[model samples]
Target: MGTVIVVGAGIGGVTAAVALQRCGWGVTVLERSVTLGEVGAGISVWPSAVAVLTELGVKGIDQAAALSGPTALRKPSGRWVVGAADLGVELPVMIHRAQLHGLITAEFGPGVTVRTGYLVKTVTQDDSGVLINDELRADLVIAADGLRSVIRSALHPQYAGPRYSGYTAYRGIADVRADDGGETWGQAQRFGVTQLIDGRAYWYATANQPAGQGGDLAAVIRRYGGWHDPIPAILAATDTALQNDIYDLTLPLVPFATGRIALLGDAAHAMTPNLGRGACTAIEDAGALARHLQSAPDPLTALTRYDAERRPIATKLVKRSRQIGQLGQLDNPLAVGVRDVLMSVGASAARGAAALRKMKQSRRDHSSAGS
Candidate 1:
């Protein structure tokens, strides 16, 4: 066990700190912000990420219940395309981003130290150790500095960085009643609503727009107001809206590790949020990196193993997420019609397959009981 400096104090950065500390490493987390906390509205924590947090001793998340109501995809007029249960998909537990961040940071023990408002301008490494900002030094560096990470640029200067997805996203938490929640697909635009653990509704929407086109709550309302039901109500209840021009890292992502530095989370693999797996993937990355470090003979060897284990999976996720976004954001009438029809057909087939399996299991159970 040795000293490590984790760049950025986001969810992924803090998670890496906790995992590293549990493995007997002294951890220091650096953040450029004046204060430490997340700013997002709500985030989905799938079972895989929940398990990682449990292994890291994060508590209170298990109490945050998963989605109980059926989640479905619909046309702008509320016609169902597919329900998540029809496809046997497992829904994730939705928690407020700030709450989740707090739970993870609560696990920070004496071995963990945090430095807020510290911007990492430079990082260099040798066989012995890694250096940061010309002064701070650590045996290893975990760069969890998010999509536009400076460390990532310094390491892979030749790599293409963030790529605009030709759309902008809007998100907000609404204090309104929405029992059953899911997504509504429109021509080149979409709206999704789900209940957070606290019972408040979390809603997000996307529109095909050029980058840097600014928008506000009014803009979101104008776009999605007349489309559906609870969507208008949800927006009316929201006091503020957050808008971001969606961007993901370019394909053929940079390696996760090099020498004494390892990239974690968005720094290594930033993907579109179409699959809602970006944060979950980062959590998995932290868990895997810690496991490899504990078993390997040296830090360098551990990073190599970590890269080999995580990169392929991350690559696949990035590709698959991009594909989903493309399909969901179809604008042309013919293309949208074709996409919806195909999705509906696929969902019907999935339902049939699931029923067949259930019937088979029931028959086996009855036979065993009689015997």
Candidate 2:
């Protein structure tokens, strides 16, 4: 058996470490941060990812999070747009990001060694093994480093960097409680609120803004300040909030590997958060990678198989997520009208419920296939 070195302790890295360790590999995780921390936000785990986590033995999958139905897309004035119920695996569950990270970290035990604050400056590999920071050789090196991956640049220098999606996202956890979870779409902007397991509401807003332009929370409220029920109240009740410019990287529908080193998660295919599949896809990557390694003859062959199995699905998701973001940010009057009309036609309660059933059926089919 040989050692595996995984960079970045984000969701993908930690999950990969645990999965590989179970396969009898000695794993070392190097993280640049001093401590494992996650941005204060909520993440929706789709059924595909829920199945992955359950397989990993992650605890509290259904309880430590809010198990809700799909979000109903509504107008700024609180008028019903269309409920996502028709698209439907229990409408996905929302969990605090840090909690999920902590759950994954707990699975490794003594089989994995995690080193924080050791930023990988460079990487070099040969036929024998891979090296990190000019030293430390390992049979396999996994880069889950994230959007600005040092290993990715070292391996694929010709790759185009992440591009700003011409919008910004504002996130906050509010004290208010909302039972029926959903979102409101205003012109060029959108807002969503969902309850956490602890009963706090995790909310976010996205607006059409240029890259690098920070937002004023007060100003955003004033702009959309007059919108529907609970939104104004939710924004007003927010104790803290932060804004980030949304960006997506160009992920080709190809394998993100070169010999001994391979990329996973955001490093391989960073997508917009529109469909809430970013972390879910990463978890799926971990499962696929683990399954490949467990069955293959060697690490190199296993990585090749992993790349082949994951690239197409992850690439399609990245592209779909970006498209969803574009649709969410439609601001022009004519475009907005058209979008509203489409939503009105597509978002009836019956349609929404049917979508949810179809999503659930897809999950069932996938699970049965995997079994």
Candidate 3:
């Protein structure tokens, strides 16, 4: 067994801690915050991430509500561009961010220790291990510090990090019971709605805005109130809103591993929330790190394997999410029209394909019955 220090106590770092502890490693998680918890309205935990959490011994994820009903891509006027079911894609379960965080952290066993308000101002590594602030040392370091990760900046100062996406995002949990859920794309703005496990609706919106231009729930209403039916209702039922200027790591993200420290989650690859895969990706990273450590000959080898396995996949996601955000946030009238039309065409094609598959299956069943 080896000693490891995990920076940041967010979902990714805690998941990493639990994974490492289960693998017979003594894990210490350090958080700069005064207390341990997560902030955010709602998050989607896709099946891939759920598998990773299950392997790590985290429970209660199955209790989250699976997305039901048709999720659609729509215009601001509530005209549908595409229905999600037509695409034949799998959807994620919806849960409150805090509830999901609590489930992951609860899996921390006696082998894991946590220190809050402990910030690592300086991190240096030598041939033996990595040192933090000249006080704590560990055989390995897992940096999950987040999008503006201090550890990442220290490790790769030359690399330009945290590029803004030319849009700001708003998130909130609304008390309304509206059943319809999906996204509506307008000129330079977009809104999404989905029901959480608790029956509260979670809604998120994005607007083309300058970085650092702050906004709140009222601002969200002002921007999207007139768009559609439940959009206004959801806003009216909301008490508060969270806003963040969207940002993703610059293309060619820094390597996930350098020396004894391995970057996980947003530290390794941060992307826009367009795909709802940010936290899921981080959970996957933690799982991969632990898996590699179990089989590899040494910690360094494990880190190398982790880097190789995770980087390319994360890079593709970062690129794709950004592109989707660009398309969703189109402001130009002509461009928006074109995008909507293309989406409608794609959805129709997908529905036709799905119908064909079903028809073929039905024919096979009928022939078997005759036989």
Best by lDDT: 3
Q: By TM-score, who's the top model here?
A: 1
Evaluated at residue 74, the lDDT of candidate 2 is: 85
Q: TM-score of model 3 relative to the true fold?
A: 0.97
TM-score of candidate 2 relative to the true fold: 0.92
> What TM-scores do the predictions have?
0.98, 0.92, 0.97
Residue 224 of model 1, lDDT score: 91
- What candidate 1 gets wrong by more than 4 Å, as runs, is 64-68
Q: List the residue pairs that clash in candidate 1.
A: none
lDDT of 1 by residue, 49-79 (tens): 9999999999999676445356889988878
Q: What value of lDDT does candidate 3 attain over all alpha carbons?
A: 0.92
User: Candidate 3 lDDT, tens digit per residue, 41-120?
Assistant: 88998989999999888988878555644688888898888987776878888888899999998898899999999988
lDDT values, one for every candidate: 0.91, 0.85, 0.92
> What is the C-alpha lDDT profile of model 2 across 149-176, one tens digit per residue?
9999988888786878888998888888
Stretches > 4 Å off in candidate 3: 64-69, 365-371
Off by over 4 Å in 2: 84-90, 251-254, 348-371
